[model samples]
Target: ARRVVATLSIGKRSHFATARVAMEAYAKRVGAEFVVVDSTAHASLARWNATLHSGSNSHFMKLPMLQWFLEHYDQLLFLDDDVLVSPFAPDLFSSVPCEAFGAVYEGYHKQGWHSMHARSFCSLYGLA
Candidate 1:
């Protein structure tokens, strides 16, 4: 069984602080190890790898933090602060495919790919 840890980054914003509190409660309820990355304090550490093109996008910092978690954990669940974990949410670590990265599709488009949003555009233009 792969040991899993949950992680989230919190900026200096107030909303993010509230989100962190919620995430911490969720982590406690699920009996999972929770890691909080302080974007305001350790922003420089995340820039060690120039290839990632981290820029001002604090979300990119998760890359280095994820790597660090990988060293100590078998798998990592990187959740955004904005996400609200439901009590009914399934155990994700057990469902993740072996040797493959897993992510949920936001399902913004029900028809063709043409209706996809900015993320699709970034993928197409190689900017993401």
Candidate 2:
């Protein structure tokens, strides 16, 4: 299956520099193409915004990005530009079923921020 690992990097904040090298190497090792989309680029953002409900906000770009990638590639692993992949980490896609959606649980964050947010989100959505 054709596989890609991609991220959106907006503005000039050195969005992917710190993590790109490691992630690129990991993508190579895992036989997946690595891509970094600069959302600030006119054509890139324009294309994403063309999708229904897509907006100019950088955070909202993920939906359109996922839509485009899933249409073109068999599978994609999307990551935030701030994320760093460890050299010792295993191939993340190998263990999952291709048809299933997968995500890493960040509720275990050291500061409990994600956990707290999740709880609040659950309560707000009446899922608690």
Model 1, position 128, has a per-residue lDDT of 57
Best-fitting candidate, measured by lDDT? Answer: 2
lDDT by residue (tens digit), candidate 2, 1-128: 98999888777856356567667988999999988887545343555565535543455767766877887778899988767666677887886667988898754467867456545544643546
The local distance difference test score of model 2 is 0.72
Give all TM-scores, in the order shown.
0.57, 0.71
Backbone Cα, N, C clashes tallied per candidate: 0, 0
lDDT by residue (tens digit), candidate 1, 10-44: 44544455445546666665556777666534533
Off by over 4 Å in 2: 40-47, 51-59, 108-128
Worst 10 residues of 1 by lDDT: 113-122
Local error of candidate 2 at residue 106 (angstroms) = 1.7
Angstrom error at residue 39, model 1: 3.9
TM-score of 2: 0.71
